[model samples]
Target: MSTPHCLRSSWHAAPANGGRRENGRVNDFDPTAYLPDDLLERIRERAPRHDRENTFPEADLDELRDAGYLAILVPAELGGAGLGLAEASALQQRLAGAAPATALAINMHLVWTGVAKVLSDRGVDALRFVQEGAVAGDVFGFGISEAGNDLVLFGSGTDAAPQADGGYAFTGTKIFTSLAPVWTQLGLHGLDTTSPDGPKMVYAFVPRSEESAGRIVTRDDWDTLGMRGTQSRTTELHCAVAPPERVARRIDPGPNPDPLVFGIFSVFELLLASVYTGIARRALDLAVAAAAKRTSKRTGKPYSQDPDIRWRIAGMALAYDALPPQLDALARDVDGLADHGTRWFSLLSGMKHRAVTAAKTIVDDAVLVAGGSSYFASNELGRLYRDVLAGLFHPSDPESAHSTVATAWLGPLED
Candidate 1:
């Protein structure tokens, strides 16, 4: 399939020398340049401290912002790297390998920018502010997840009261609000049941700076078993207002095929899958290192020489290898606007499911390969073991993924 005309403007592809246009200036597009080895080492060194103290990785965020990592998805004309979702996925995987919590937290911000990119490429410019905001160093928070609202994206439990000035006053609690401490703008959705066209699902962004005080509250209730650095605290909205210009979409609720809905799901799932895939890569690397270092007392040789140990590592590698290709392909599909129709949901969700489940399994085996020492709190593997579990809780979870895929394959179970 041919790529979209908008994407052909050098936003999705770079020259053979890896030169990309950033604000009309030619620059290298090397992933390592954006996230250098030294930077990743610094982030990796801080992961344990953040996890132990249950604190957010403020330094990581600062370094990432300084490196222009946050603007990777925005167009070059907007002073960003002008990369595609496929490139963004690869970068997220690399970032996650160094610090999963930081990657997960930043994922929320990227989701908004990514969705904007997706929409803009398709000629829907409603979310152009998201792209421009990202370029301007604005941090975005994902506030779509609400407590017990399983019909995500399709429905909202929060109330989006329409104001006379074409704005929305949102009132509800949003859970798992990542980047809670630093988000400058929050992209969220709520139900507007009292409008003339009642039952519209409203998508909007509320200012999170001091300018919008008292209307929004961020709860410091982020203590969790893993992914602690995400600081995904709960947020309370006391009629928080999204100004007229900030109101992005107000579509009919429940399974509608809106561009906003598709953009969010596609970007969110693909980037999410990328993070877990990175975790699996990290786990696999750790296992390989451990195997080569540990000696088998029975054979007086390194564990790497042991048949069973080698087999276990091979299994992990096999599982880890399958995900990146799928991520790259699907991400390219989204970037190129290849048609997938209704199957897009199933494919996206399935990719996320495969990534998380494989990451968990790979991490589990990694701990085993590293032996009892890995069980210690100081061991990185121990931290990873805890961090990988957070994947099960994200959207398109095991049950939901299976259900979506099953329904796509089998006609919605006679309903």
Candidate 2:
């Protein structure tokens, strides 16, 4: 009945999620304004409709901007709260605890924060695009995933061919461009072949409205079964990319060698686990609540009185409390990330694999406990069940993440 002590930390509330700092680092953040109870309530009110129509939660988007969550990842010195990915991951878990749609939609804003980290100072224009979204009351989501692309690799069929003025023109398709429909500003994360310097995978932060037409960036509609409210659309960015000076890293067509950036992958994995954890928690909550009232047809006993049902409930609760120490350990290690090696990648990946898998098990237990109630659309647990099922395949399939982590751990010793 009470909130978990691990999550009851002073952080994970407003502005503590990932607010940026004044100089654009975490030190510059103001966490108080961002994590009020009111914002969570606002997000919940829109979940059902957002799911039913498969539309972006525009109202909630407005609320997020007003709360300054768009810059939550920015440091306090940078005129934003400087919440790091570790904190953001926790924030996401809490948000997902309330509504998967809300958490999923907010990812776009977070990835833009990724661009901010990757770019450092070279991304002034990109940073402006993100800030402008805050000003305009919209959050930018990325269109990076393609349906056919393997989950393990950063695959892109889209290309940014050269333009005469020194900027490259991006052409080709990108899928699962989540948050594009609601984002006023957009960025297509891809490899551009036309850079004045050389080929590279750079983020092109451009506008989404008709005003940016001849300048490039187009969107195609998307409809999906789970996280339907995210509006993950297809986008065609057939426009000039940022000049070399305005861009971040040039495209690495092959695997990135640097392990520090691997932390981003860990952050993503943690965020998804957070989302799945929240969904599983809600599902279990509903199941436990429903079990109290529903009587079994066979024995005319309350569902809660059934031995099997009680066991399932206990299992789900165990999962909810199981992984915090692991996740928290990962969070603390982030402060000393500069000292991390390949071992960091292995540990983080393993943690993600474990946490997500546990969340999946909780979902299974939730469905078994709820029985028929989980099948109804009106039931939040039902929506959550679908969302949890989707998580098993999210980011990378469970098999790949496991193998990848396992190989990372053993590959060095053998070599």
- Model 2 residue 120 CA deviation (Å) reads 5.1
* Candidate 2: segments with Cα more than 4 A from true spot: 1-33, 114-138, 151-155, 164-166, 192-199, 209-211, 214-220, 243-246, 258-260, 295-302, 335-338, 412-415
Q: Give the alpha carbon lDDT tens digit for every residue of 201-317 in model 1.
A: 999999986767989999999999899999999999989999999999998877766677778888999999999999999999999999999998888999999999999999999
- For model 1, the stretches where C-alpha displacement exceeds 4 angstroms are 1-29
lDDT of 2 by residue, 71-173 (tens): 7766565576656665666667667877797787787667666445433422123354454445445566665566566632343566666556645456666
Q: How close is candidate 2 to the true structure, as a TM-score?
A: 0.80
Error of 2 at 230 (Å): 0.2
